[model samples]
Target: MNIASKIFNSHSKEDGDFFLAMTRILGFKPRKLGVYKKAFLHRSVNKRDKKGNPLNYERLEFLGDAMLGTIISKHLYTEVPAGDEGYLTKMRSKIVSRKHLNELGKDLNLIEHVESKIPKAHFGDNIHGNVFEALIGAIYLDRGYTYCEKFIHDRVIVPYVDIEQLEGKVISYKSLVIEWCQKQKYSFEYEVYEDTGNDPVKHFGVKLYINGKVMAKARATSKKKAEEKASKRAFYALQDRISKN
Candidate 1:
């Protein structure tokens, strides 16, 4: 029997909805509803299995991450015969970047099915990516590697993994800025300060300084994001110098 046939034989409306949703996303039936359920379960629910193992998607997320990396690696190895280890690694990073995964989840509307105690609006951007990874893990566990591979190939690889475009994609602007500064032997610093936004959400401001010169400034909901934003601005400011090196 398929996932819905064996696992979702009940008359619960929620189960029916979940079955249909999984079918739409996976382009096939899911074997174990409970397995996929745990994929979306938040730790805040405080549930546990018969063996007393914690019930949450974290472990599944780890497995999915590994699967994504392994499958992407194989594709890169075959497609880019000229790529060295470092080049292939970088390309894979670009394809599976957090931002890209978050986009994928958003495209699939995965967050709508998340069962969490916290309000959906309160969740961070990474929640989308986390569930996406967890879904991959659930697929692996439900039907094994072949189905897992097919799901990734259809949902992730075919639609988004473009080597030619990815070559120019910069996953992290902050990393690029730091690399450029290091290569050119220029000292740089990201000076952070309290953000003055009146919004309820916390914010941070950062100023990117290169050789005692203020290159760019930006503000965001988190320090890392603020720094990255500042670095992006700094990159454009020094694009010519950075690109040549």
Candidate 2:
């Protein structure tokens, strides 16, 4: 398409606002708006292409995840020459951790542009991060690696990443607690059970047992959350012991 045609197409009523929004978020005019739109296309919409294949952001999310990892790995490789493979991998995990990605997505308000049959309020916390990965995948497909790297550097690395702070940041308190327990040779268990108490949603309750004694208890909508919550409480309660050893 000619320049004028491209401009006219982008300004069409159906996608004009979306086009402008993409330009602002991407920091450049997108060559294919469809790819960008696919990033926000939730699977609940049940869209399909001519080939009868499901069309959603899931594929793009996978691609974006790989792309994000590659770019972040390269950055870490260059910046931290002394870090070994394990250290670098852990640092990268900390940077692209789901919690961090969710924060980034929320900051960008990426959910506002989602095309979904489901209500936004019904979406889980990870939805923001999932779409964020989808957006990165779309960027890679539309503009290739260079553009993808630039976007990550601009939005994630330069703005949010701090090497020193990230070094001390705990990605998973549960992991820390488990590692500590294993190293100290203490018997540990997470006893989880259904705990729906007056709440409409069924909850899971977990008790963190160390040395066969209940160290902490917590409840959440999911078993994993409850376990993590209980582990966090256990960590704080036994911080001095854990830290000293």
Per residue, candidate 1 scores C-alpha lDDT tens digits across 1-245 of: 65455444755767878887877777887778788888888887888999999999999999999998899899999999999999999989988999999977776778888888888999999988999999999999999999988989987887567575588666778998999899989999999998856533356899999999999999865687688778878988797765788
lDDT of 1 at 119: 89
Q: Which ten residues in a row have the lowest lDDT in candidate 1?
A: 2-11
Q: Candidate 1 at residue 81, lDDT?
A: 100
Can you write out model 2's per-residue Cα lDDT over 1-245, one digit (the tens) per residue? 85435666757755777776777777777888899989999999999999999999999999999999999999999999999999999999999999999977876778999999999999999998999999999999999999999999988897567686588776667898999899989999999999978653457899999999999999865687688778878988898765788
Segments in model 1 whose C-alpha atoms lie over 4 Å from true places: 1-11, 169-245
lDDT of each: 0.84, 0.87
Model 2, runs deviating above 4 Å: 1-11, 169-245
Q: Which candidate tops lDDT?
A: 2
lDDT of 2: 0.87
RMSD of 1: 10.7
